[model samples]
Target: MRSHHSLTNKAWAEFHVDGLPHVHRVFPNGESTMAIVDGLVHGDYVAAAVNDTAVTLTLFSWPASSISRYCYAIHLQIGRVEGPTGRLAVCVQVTAAREVSPVEDYWCMTVDERVALFDRGNAHPVATFRLEYENQRTVELPK
Candidate 1:
Protein backbone atom coordinates (compact mmCIF):
# COMPACT_ATOMS: atom_id res chain seq x y z
CA MET A 1 0.00 0.00 0.00
CA ARG A 2 1.10 3.55 -0.88
CA SER A 3 -0.34 6.85 0.31
CA HIS A 4 -0.14 10.53 -0.56
CA HIS A 5 -1.24 13.67 1.19
CA SER A 6 -2.12 16.48 -1.11
CA LEU A 7 -1.67 20.20 -0.52
CA THR A 8 -5.44 20.46 -0.23
CA ASN A 9 -5.18 18.20 2.85
CA LYS A 10 -6.77 15.26 1.07
CA ALA A 11 -5.22 11.95 2.03
CA TRP A 12 -5.06 9.30 -0.69
CA ALA A 13 -4.14 5.63 -0.44
CA GLU A 14 -3.54 3.00 -3.06
CA PHE A 15 -3.37 -0.75 -2.60
CA HIS A 16 -2.00 -3.24 -5.06
CA VAL A 17 -2.78 -6.87 -4.30
CA ASP A 18 -2.30 -9.81 -6.62
CA GLY A 19 -1.66 -7.43 -9.49
CA LEU A 20 -4.90 -5.47 -8.98
CA PRO A 21 -4.90 -1.83 -7.99
CA HIS A 22 -7.42 0.03 -5.83
CA VAL A 23 -7.29 3.69 -4.85
CA HIS A 24 -9.14 5.74 -2.24
CA ARG A 25 -9.15 9.29 -0.89
CA VAL A 26 -9.85 10.36 2.70
CA PHE A 27 -10.52 13.88 3.90
CA PRO A 28 -12.02 15.59 6.88
CA ASN A 29 -15.69 16.36 6.35
CA GLY A 30 -16.29 18.54 9.41
CA GLU A 31 -14.49 19.11 12.68
CA SER A 32 -14.93 15.47 13.69
CA THR A 33 -16.25 13.55 10.69
CA MET A 34 -14.37 12.19 7.68
CA ALA A 35 -15.28 11.45 4.05
CA ILE A 36 -13.91 8.92 1.58
CA VAL A 37 -14.09 8.49 -2.17
CA ASP A 38 -12.89 5.52 -4.20
CA GLY A 39 -11.97 5.00 -7.83
CA LEU A 40 -13.59 2.07 -9.60
CA VAL A 41 -11.22 -0.48 -11.07
CA HIS A 42 -12.04 -3.54 -13.10
CA GLY A 43 -11.70 -7.12 -11.81
CA ASP A 44 -11.20 -6.34 -8.11
CA TYR A 45 -13.49 -4.51 -5.71
CA VAL A 46 -12.96 -1.75 -3.14
CA ALA A 47 -15.32 -0.31 -0.57
CA ALA A 48 -14.78 2.66 1.74
CA ALA A 49 -17.08 3.81 4.51
CA VAL A 50 -16.92 6.33 7.33
CA ASN A 51 -18.83 6.56 10.58
CA ASP A 52 -18.75 8.85 13.59
CA THR A 53 -15.54 7.28 14.93
CA ALA A 54 -13.58 5.69 12.11
CA VAL A 55 -12.98 5.16 8.41
CA THR A 56 -12.66 1.65 6.99
CA LEU A 57 -11.33 0.58 3.62
CA THR A 58 -11.79 -2.98 2.41
CA LEU A 59 -10.39 -4.63 -0.69
CA PHE A 60 -11.69 -7.88 -2.16
CA SER A 61 -10.08 -9.95 -4.87
CA TRP A 62 -10.57 -13.35 -6.50
CA PRO A 63 -7.49 -15.30 -7.49
CA ALA A 64 -7.69 -17.28 -10.68
CA SER A 65 -5.58 -20.17 -9.40
CA SER A 66 -7.42 -20.66 -6.13
CA ILE A 67 -10.97 -21.28 -5.01
CA SER A 68 -10.48 -19.26 -1.84
CA ARG A 69 -11.17 -15.51 -1.75
CA TYR A 70 -9.00 -12.82 -0.20
CA CYS A 71 -9.96 -9.71 1.72
CA TYR A 72 -7.76 -6.93 3.10
CA ALA A 73 -9.00 -4.10 5.24
CA ILE A 74 -7.74 -1.07 7.14
CA HIS A 75 -9.47 0.74 9.96
CA LEU A 76 -8.45 4.22 11.12
CA GLN A 77 -9.58 5.75 14.38
CA ILE A 78 -8.69 8.94 16.19
CA GLY A 79 -7.17 8.47 19.59
CA ARG A 80 -4.92 10.09 22.18
CA VAL A 81 -1.44 9.05 23.22
CA GLU A 82 -0.75 8.20 26.84
CA GLY A 83 0.38 11.38 28.56
CA PRO A 84 -0.75 14.17 30.77
CA THR A 85 -1.35 16.38 27.77
CA GLY A 86 -2.79 13.46 25.81
CA ARG A 87 -1.61 14.29 22.33
CA LEU A 88 -3.85 13.27 19.45
CA ALA A 89 -3.03 10.26 17.29
CA VAL A 90 -4.58 8.07 14.67
CA CYS A 91 -4.80 4.38 15.54
CA VAL A 92 -4.76 2.14 12.52
CA GLN A 93 -5.51 -1.56 12.32
CA VAL A 94 -4.94 -3.74 9.29
CA THR A 95 -6.48 -7.16 8.82
CA ALA A 96 -6.26 -9.74 6.08
CA ALA A 97 -8.18 -12.99 5.67
CA ARG A 98 -5.90 -15.89 6.57
CA GLU A 99 -7.76 -18.76 4.97
CA VAL A 100 -11.05 -19.93 3.62
CA SER A 101 -13.57 -21.23 6.07
CA PRO A 102 -17.09 -22.55 6.11
CA VAL A 103 -19.76 -19.85 5.99
CA GLU A 104 -21.25 -21.11 9.24
CA ASP A 105 -17.94 -20.91 11.10
CA TYR A 106 -17.18 -17.48 9.74
CA TRP A 107 -20.49 -16.07 10.90
CA CYS A 108 -19.84 -17.26 14.43
CA MET A 109 -16.79 -15.00 14.93
CA THR A 110 -17.18 -11.38 15.92
CA VAL A 111 -15.25 -8.59 14.23
CA ASP A 112 -13.40 -7.66 17.40
CA GLU A 113 -12.23 -11.20 18.06
CA ARG A 114 -11.08 -11.64 14.48
CA VAL A 115 -9.06 -8.43 14.71
CA ALA A 116 -7.60 -9.61 17.98
CA LEU A 117 -6.52 -12.83 16.36
CA PHE A 118 -4.81 -10.92 13.60
CA ASP A 119 -3.01 -8.78 16.16
CA ARG A 120 -1.83 -11.95 17.90
CA GLY A 121 0.08 -12.94 14.75
CA ASN A 122 -2.56 -15.01 12.97
CA ALA A 123 -2.18 -12.67 9.99
CA HIS A 124 0.87 -11.72 7.92
CA PRO A 125 2.27 -8.31 7.04
CA VAL A 126 0.69 -6.47 9.93
CA ALA A 127 1.20 -2.71 10.34
CA THR A 128 0.31 0.27 12.47
CA PHE A 129 0.07 3.90 11.34
CA ARG A 130 0.40 6.67 13.88
CA LEU A 131 -0.59 10.07 12.57
CA GLU A 132 0.22 12.73 15.13
CA TYR A 133 -1.79 15.91 15.25
CA GLU A 134 0.20 19.04 16.06
CA ASN A 135 -0.55 21.88 13.68
CA GLN A 136 -1.61 19.31 11.10
CA ARG A 137 -1.75 15.54 10.76
CA THR A 138 1.59 14.06 9.76
CA VAL A 139 2.18 10.46 8.70
CA GLU A 140 5.48 8.56 8.66
CA LEU A 141 5.29 5.84 6.07
CA PRO A 142 7.12 2.58 6.57
CA LYS A 143 10.49 2.36 4.92
Candidate 2:
Protein backbone atom coordinates (compact mmCIF):
# COMPACT_ATOMS: atom_id res chain seq x y z
CA MET A 1 0.00 0.00 0.00
CA ARG A 2 1.16 3.52 -0.56
CA SER A 3 2.20 5.36 2.55
CA HIS A 4 0.01 8.20 3.78
CA HIS A 5 2.95 10.56 3.30
CA SER A 6 3.30 9.39 -0.26
CA LEU A 7 -0.34 9.99 -0.97
CA THR A 8 -0.29 13.45 0.55
CA ASN A 9 2.90 14.34 -1.27
CA LYS A 10 1.33 13.28 -4.53
CA ALA A 11 -1.91 15.17 -4.02
CA TRP A 12 -0.31 18.48 -3.02
CA ALA A 13 1.66 21.00 -5.06
CA GLU A 14 4.12 22.91 -2.89
CA PHE A 15 4.54 26.68 -2.80
CA HIS A 16 5.48 29.34 -0.28
CA VAL A 17 2.72 31.20 1.59
CA ASP A 18 4.33 34.58 2.15
CA GLY A 19 2.75 36.40 -0.80
CA LEU A 20 -0.32 36.19 -3.05
CA PRO A 21 -2.58 38.41 -0.98
CA HIS A 22 -6.01 37.40 -2.37
CA VAL A 23 -7.41 33.90 -2.92
CA HIS A 24 -8.67 31.39 -5.52
CA ARG A 25 -5.86 30.57 -7.92
CA VAL A 26 -4.20 28.24 -10.46
CA PHE A 27 -0.76 27.73 -11.88
CA PRO A 28 0.65 26.12 -14.99
CA ASN A 29 3.90 25.41 -13.26
CA GLY A 30 3.81 22.85 -10.47
CA GLU A 31 6.05 24.69 -8.04
CA SER A 32 4.31 28.04 -8.18
CA THR A 33 0.88 27.10 -6.87
CA MET A 34 -0.05 27.50 -3.17
CA ALA A 35 -2.82 28.93 -0.99
CA ILE A 36 -2.24 31.49 1.74
CA VAL A 37 -4.35 31.11 4.86
CA ASP A 38 -4.61 33.88 7.44
CA GLY A 39 -3.12 32.09 10.45
CA LEU A 40 -1.25 29.18 9.00
CA VAL A 41 1.88 28.24 7.13
CA HIS A 42 2.45 26.26 3.96
CA GLY A 43 0.90 22.77 3.92
CA ASP A 44 -1.65 23.64 6.57
CA TYR A 45 -4.81 22.35 4.92
CA VAL A 46 -4.47 22.75 1.22
CA ALA A 47 -5.81 20.83 -1.79
CA ALA A 48 -4.24 20.09 -5.14
CA ALA A 49 -5.89 19.35 -8.45
CA VAL A 50 -5.01 19.44 -12.12
CA ASN A 51 -6.37 19.39 -15.64
CA ASP A 52 -4.70 18.58 -18.96
CA THR A 53 -2.49 21.66 -18.75
CA ALA A 54 -2.23 23.35 -15.34
CA VAL A 55 -2.23 22.67 -11.60
CA THR A 56 -4.11 24.36 -8.72
CA LEU A 57 -3.58 24.69 -4.99
CA THR A 58 -6.41 25.58 -2.60
CA LEU A 59 -6.59 26.26 1.11
CA PHE A 60 -9.29 24.30 2.90
CA SER A 61 -8.89 25.06 6.61
CA TRP A 62 -6.72 24.75 9.68
CA PRO A 63 -7.10 21.83 12.07
CA ALA A 64 -8.47 23.80 15.03
CA SER A 65 -9.91 26.79 13.25
CA SER A 66 -13.57 27.29 12.51
CA ILE A 67 -14.65 28.10 8.92
CA SER A 68 -18.33 27.31 9.37
CA ARG A 69 -19.71 30.87 9.47
CA TYR A 70 -16.90 33.08 8.29
CA CYS A 71 -16.12 34.44 4.83
CA TYR A 72 -13.91 31.36 4.19
CA ALA A 73 -10.85 33.17 2.99
CA ILE A 74 -8.33 31.46 0.70
CA HIS A 75 -5.08 32.32 -1.06
CA LEU A 76 -4.68 31.11 -4.63
CA GLN A 77 -1.48 31.33 -6.71
CA ILE A 78 -1.62 31.35 -10.50
CA GLY A 79 0.36 32.32 -13.61
CA ARG A 80 2.52 31.19 -16.53
CA VAL A 81 6.00 29.95 -15.60
CA GLU A 82 9.29 30.47 -17.38
CA GLY A 83 12.38 29.02 -15.78
CA PRO A 84 12.96 31.05 -12.57
CA THR A 85 12.05 34.30 -14.22
CA GLY A 86 8.30 34.51 -14.33
CA ARG A 87 6.03 36.83 -12.36
CA LEU A 88 3.89 34.02 -10.97
CA ALA A 89 1.47 35.13 -8.22
CA VAL A 90 -2.07 36.36 -7.53
CA CYS A 91 -4.89 35.81 -4.97
CA VAL A 92 -8.64 35.28 -5.09
CA GLN A 93 -11.43 34.27 -2.74
CA VAL A 94 -12.79 30.69 -2.61
CA THR A 95 -16.47 30.56 -1.92
CA ALA A 96 -19.13 27.92 -1.77
CA ALA A 97 -18.42 26.07 -4.99
CA ARG A 98 -21.03 23.65 -3.83
CA GLU A 99 -23.94 24.21 -1.54
CA VAL A 100 -23.17 23.79 2.13
CA SER A 101 -23.91 20.15 2.79
CA PRO A 102 -24.68 18.09 5.86
CA VAL A 103 -21.14 16.83 5.70
CA GLU A 104 -19.23 19.65 7.28
CA ASP A 105 -15.91 18.68 5.78
CA TYR A 106 -16.94 19.08 2.19
CA TRP A 107 -15.35 21.87 0.13
CA CYS A 108 -17.55 24.80 -0.68
CA MET A 109 -17.14 26.67 -3.93
CA THR A 110 -15.75 30.14 -4.19
CA VAL A 111 -18.30 32.93 -4.31
CA ASP A 112 -17.52 33.07 -8.02
CA GLU A 113 -17.91 29.29 -8.20
CA ARG A 114 -14.47 28.56 -9.75
CA VAL A 115 -10.76 28.92 -9.21
CA ALA A 116 -9.00 30.78 -12.00
CA LEU A 117 -5.59 30.83 -13.68
CA PHE A 118 -4.17 33.69 -15.67
CA ASP A 119 -1.30 36.09 -16.10
CA ARG A 120 -0.82 38.92 -13.63
CA GLY A 121 -3.62 41.53 -13.76
CA ASN A 122 -5.81 39.15 -15.81
CA ALA A 123 -8.87 37.53 -14.20
CA HIS A 124 -9.92 33.95 -14.90
CA PRO A 125 -10.88 30.80 -13.02
CA VAL A 126 -9.36 27.40 -13.71
CA ALA A 127 -10.96 24.61 -11.69
CA THR A 128 -14.11 23.68 -9.83
CA PHE A 129 -14.49 22.38 -6.26
CA ARG A 130 -14.84 18.66 -5.59
CA LEU A 131 -14.03 18.36 -1.90
CA GLU A 132 -14.55 20.22 1.38
CA TYR A 133 -13.54 19.74 4.98
CA GLU A 134 -13.92 21.09 8.49
CA ASN A 135 -10.15 20.84 8.72
CA GLN A 136 -7.31 21.64 6.40
CA ARG A 137 -6.68 19.42 3.36
CA THR A 138 -3.01 18.67 2.98
CA VAL A 139 -1.60 18.34 -0.54
CA GLU A 140 1.28 16.73 -2.39
CA LEU A 141 1.89 16.86 -6.14
CA PRO A 142 3.98 14.79 -8.53
CA LYS A 143 7.53 15.89 -8.97
**Model 2: CA > 4 A from native:** 1-44, 49-54, 62-68, 71-75, 81-85, 94-143
- The local lDDT score (0 to 100) that residue 65 gets in candidate 1 is 24
Q: Which candidate number has the best lDDT? A: 1
After superposition, candidate 1 runs with Cα above 4 Å error: 1-68, 79-87, 99-125, 136-143
- lDDT digits (tens) for residues 15-37 of candidate 2: 43432323322333443223334
Model 1 lDDT-worst window of ten = 33-42
lDDT of 1: 0.39
lDDT of 1 at 5: 45
Best by TM-score: 1
